[model samples]
Target: MKTKLWFLLGTLALLLTGCQSKNNSGSAQQLNLMQTSDLLSLDTSQHADLPTWNTLENSMEGLYRADKHNQPQAAMATKVVQPTNQGKTYTFSLRKNAKWSNGEPVVAQDFVTAWRRSVSSKAQSGYNYIFSGIQNADAISKGQKAPRKLGVKALDKHTLQVQLEHPMPYFNKMMVMPAFFPQNRTALKKFKSHYGTQSKYLYYNGPFKVTKWTGDNDSWVLMRNKYYYDKKQIHLNKIKYLVVKDANTAHELFSQNKLDDATITGVTAKELQGSKNLIHEKKAGNYYLRVNVRNNQPLANAKMRQAINLAIDRQALTKNILADGSLPASTYTAKDLSIDPTTKKDFAQETTPQQTYNVKQARTLWDEGRQEANLPKKLTLKVLGDDQTITKNVAEFLQDELQHNLPGVKVQIRNVPDKTASSETRSGQFNLSQTLWLADFADPISFMGILNSDNPQNYGKYHDDQFDQLYQKAILDSSNNQQAYWQTLRQMQARLNESMPVIPLYQMVESHLVNPKLQGVLRHPVGEDDYTRAYLK
Candidate 1:
């Protein structure tokens, strides 16, 4: 179940498309966008994928925005003032003219209701921990406290105050997410459990409003919100999103100008390289292989897990299979993120070998572990992966590499649809699975916090009491001792390496094809909503 949560975080950016064109002969009307992923559900609390969240972020406004540099900027809130001494209280003043698409006033109580619902025991939001520091959020989520005690209060129609159990430096950044976004209480009360179900029940207070949503159909539409406070800055009138799984066909549509943007596949990258519309972005995420520690099988052993990690040739996979500028990963964190600002070097430099494809080392370790465990004569491990070509290729490569390097070990490939794969991982149904983690915000805590034992995302049941304690200290401490925090983080990494619960694979390079004419387009490291200010030339 923990594996499913981590996997969901990684797969968010797997399918998004953008377009930009310099030829300005036509009028600036509706902006048509194409994306590869199909929205599973519009229920903000239930949907965890990036594509869905991205659309929601643009269509719905939040109290704050995580900027390109990873800093939180005020959005719906006019200002956020925190008490300097204790850092436990935050005062938020809403914009005077803020209102929903239906012209209803955007009140502070909207945020209060949304936060209370998210942390409610019945909500089961994977991102419930985002508010763990809130007054009684953790207790409420665990059913030990009531929603009213969850630290959020609407002082008035336009002002909200929040009390935290401890100081959190990233609280503002976390608020930029949908889990913290306000929901229409009227719609929620009327629709009950089906509040976000079709377009009608889903109200909007952001730059764009979801005008149409047909779940069974593969397409949906978003129109600019006329009542949005910053509506004058938004140029595109409407955005229509289509879900096309076939990468080749998607690229073909892009080439023909039928689609504004598309994610190029390995087969199409070279051909589209010379196109002026091609745009490449660095991904703030990492892909890895998670081994089920609770399986009580061969993979449950640390030695066997290390052996499998050493067997695969990640460099070859990146060059041959991925063909993207993805760097090999030696640690769970991405390369750029793994660097310690104080030392200006990677934290993994202190412990663990620089990643290499060492078949001899892998074979020896596997044989030793097999002998010690008194395992069956033949070893077989099941791998769960998404239906994407890249995932299938990676899984096949791992299966071949592990089997060829280790004499008795056999690998079975189980390629399931993305949703099904997610469900299986959440249900703890796999021996091994491919997963990725995208930072919820710029902070290292965004990635580190997910592994906490009580976190809903920790599906593999990997737990470390010491690591948990250090994480708590890092978040609660007021001193800006980032170096000390890194030191503690190094210790946590050491524990993860020793446990071998997961194998870090590679850090992906995000790329998209955009028309050169689309000005005001902002690309952030976290890639939150930057389309509000985007405009056509």
Candidate 2:
């Protein structure tokens, strides 16, 4: 009996020791996520939307970070040195302690590898034009030269040298994006097409690394990387993201405290008004009606675009449909963005607001446009958009307004999935479509520059040689001529208004209910969320 009792005590001691060891090894880190969309891909170069890019920006740190005041500060790059005489030569020295999640050192060659891959013809990166200024980048992407001859190079293990075709003032802000983010060549080679799908294949050098993603699933998680250079500053151990498309469902999750942040849309904004955590942010993007210029029928006429723009009651739409702080837009660029640095005046003042809904004017313009196109009776038009509440409401409003205002016109609403809607818009399939353009960085050119004829993001294929010249000159011009740049941008806006490829709808008012526990959440006017400084209270 004595021997059996001693043996039992020894077994209990061993079990307790094992339990303690397992408990100690378990992680104490966790970050709650609040998102409505599933991340399609982690490849930043291929992403076009601001929300997706913002997610990538949060998971990966860039070379620089723009402050709330729109000033670029060092992020991955320790210092940026520019030569006075060189038109566009900039040298970057990276931080010494930076290392990927796989324990490999982040060197200048990592950036060079990512850049070369993005600019390669085989990659077909959507953002290849962003590196057009780099020597041979355009030529290489066009298959005129090998990608090895691209201007971006690593002088040593730590120093990166970039030579551009022109001097860009907002170049620093561009560096703080995925196009400039470094990637591990070894990991890329190993994973090939599936590099960024899983945590094992993707090596993160940023604040957080993706732990799990069940491709297009509702639930995904991002965990803080212990090997990150500034891991001590990361407060959240894991970020849990869920794709709850319905606004009511998202609000329900937020109210239950299951989600740390959520966007209140539709009628939910009214009930959640004045909540302690309610926050409204004005976005640089604006919703607009894109008219397919390729269609040679009724839509090709500028008068028809004007008629559609004038027929809609924007005030009622905002009050009834939006019921938020969304402002009626007279131009593509928002009012906040029109503030000229030199003249201290709004640049979009020339495009006056059409406050009153003029049905009579709309009917007259519609008749003239139809007569010019030689169409007899009713005109059949198709409007395409996503099935979201806001988009559906806009489509319904336009259908009602146009049908009522013009006696011989009928509008058909075609609702599709979000991804399908985007693809259709890109292919110019619909006669009219709803779309939005979010500024990638805090520069007037970031918004206006995309209207260039050769720009991939120019969905409408709106072209103007003079507009392109002015936009190109604005970027190359020295920072000293502030007034000249503003004037040039205003001219571009005027020309866009004349072309009428798209009719401006309204500026977006983004609202979010965030948990009081999280602190240091960074929100930029350009609609980017940088969570590097974010931590739980």
TM-score of each: 0.90, 0.88
RMSD of 2: 7.2
Q: In model 2, where do residues sit more than 4 Å from their true spots?
A: 1-29, 80-83, 120-125, 138-145, 197-201, 295-297, 349-357, 478-480
Residue lDDT tens for model 2, 220-311: 67777777887655666667777766677878888898878787665777667788988988877778887876656468877787778788
Error of 1 at 41 (Å): 1.8
Q: How far is 412's C-alpha from truth in model 2 (Å)?
A: 2.4
Query: What are the per-residue Cα lDDT tens digits for candidate 1 across 176-236?
Result: 7777889888778887877776676778898888866766566777887878887656777
In candidate 1, where is summed lDDT lowest over 10 consecutive residues? 17-26
